[model samples]
Target: MALECINLEHVPASHTIHAALFQNIKNASFLHQQLLAGNTEFEYALIDASVIISRLHALAAIYRAVNDLLGNKLRSRNVHSEIVFSLSPNNNIAESFRRFGISPETTSLLVIKVSTPSSPAAGEDIQSHLSKVVDGEQVDFSDGVLRAMTDMVRVKKIYKLNYSSGVNGRGKENAVYGSDRTSQDSKELEMLILGSMALRGATN
Candidate 1:
């Protein structure tokens, strides 16, 4: 897997992000434990790939988290944890962690870290660190890879999606661009989730 360097819109140069996707992870518990223990070396955002629908899904959360970090409105301990929180439709921090954070059963994983002047030059060494600690094969971060990893049933349950009827928990009110749900695909589903997440932060 390669470290994807992203220069987000309006975000400062120092906030550039380096992210990677992995699969067949074997030490998820240990990785999760490291995060739980607040290990500085494991500052990367370790996400359960099964819950991520696409690269955009992951990016949207990252964008929100970084935005919050820049604004000093972060609801979690840091930008990494905020990414997991941004993925949730609702704003329950702990539940978001439980659902999206890495676990012993998590086979596919996504790792993200940010570059800043004050922080260690972790982005440059991300691939090496991940290779040493994560027992998994690195893969290109793409929608095809994420799509295969996504759990449709659990995704629907988490987002309260009912695509069979093209409505969600908020019904037509939550649909974006007035698009109906009858012909939804991965693209439409992604849009719906993004819309909901946007509204969530706005309301908060």
Candidate 2:
């Protein structure tokens, strides 16, 4: 498998590689519903950078395409929207996640994409649970604008891939690589992708 890089910020607004990913999160109610559902993995509400919406959009297609390609190796879970790349006796989960990184491994990693707006407000309908968590930096892209935000994501259970850092934050914190701390292992990454794809305008 080829290594992949996610320009999360460029994702939703990207007409270049992933136009389908961010087609409708802006001012869309259905899209908002989709975002809400995507965030449910966290027992408490955790906000993703705005760019996650775009990543969600692009991965929707990738998930569908890859599932067909791997067939058995990859399974898409609808309830949680995660691409379960089964690491057989020959493979490991960490290696799979590494394949997506500059220097990756054969073990699979869960890529759970989320949707956060350009701005967030209270009472948006989210959870407030925090246990076994870590803080990190988040670099996000939106409509071509590059910026970073201080991120707090859940990290237990996912592996060494925990504690993702920010790339575009205006503050002092630098970016790190790991899982999103919005919730816990109760939800899978693929489920979030499915919900976020719904944030895009519906397909014919």
Candidate 3:
């Protein structure tokens, strides 16, 4: 199956994370409508794959959301929405949805489902439902796949990492400097993103 079951560290065993990546999605508008209409079956974190950097980036957001859910401090409606919200550097819930969540223009998608004790969804059930509802090609959810799908320009813009005097000052196309340079830059960007997310939580 394309669905990957993840066991996050420091999270309760009762909360399991299931994730999938879809490329060339054909029914983005339909999926977006389902979220807008509050379809219970569509309670998944439908993230725009372009904004995602790697599996770690996505998992970090999932961990934060689930942790909040466990503490009963969720700022959004549920753990699913909280996952998307956790990606933003600010506390603007609606803007977070618009920037990170799925839209009609989204061609690639990162779908995440968190199974909690209150709503225990089996991995098989999630895989089956996703196969039927999401019209796209399911690909392995891995760092390589995610890196290929990432839109660095958009990601830098959203995270405000485009400054000309910081870690990203080397410019977005640092790949020309060699694979090692590219890898180093990506790691720095990931740290900056995580720091921003943590700072937002601290302020709140």
Better of 1 and 3 by lDDT: 3
Q: What are the clashing pairs of model 3?
A: none
Q: Evaluated with lDDT, which candidate comes out highest?
A: 3
Runs off by more than 4 Å, candidate 3: 163-178, 201-204
**lDDT by residue for model 2 (101-126), tens:** 11111111122232324222122221
CA-lDDT, candidates in order = 0.81, 0.27, 0.86
Q: In order, how many clashes per candidate?
A: 0, 37, 0
| Stretches > 4 Å off in candidate 2 | 1-29, 32-74, 77-147, 150-204
Cα-based RMSD of candidate 3: 3.0
lDDT of candidate 1 over 14-102, digit per residue (tens): 88798788988989999989999999989888999988877888899999998898898999998899999999888889999999999
- Residue 73 in candidate 1, Cα distance off native in Å: 0.4
Q: Residue 182, candidate 3: how far off, in angstroms?
A: 1.9
- Least well predicted 10-residue stretch by lDDT in candidate 1: 165-174
- How well is each residue in 1-204 modelled by candidate 3, as lDDT tens digits? 469999988998988999999999999999999999999989999999988877878888999999899898999999999999999989899999999999999999999999988899999999999999999999989877776777777787888876332223212344353466666766777888888877884675
TM-scores for every candidate against the unseen true structure = 0.87, 0.24, 0.91
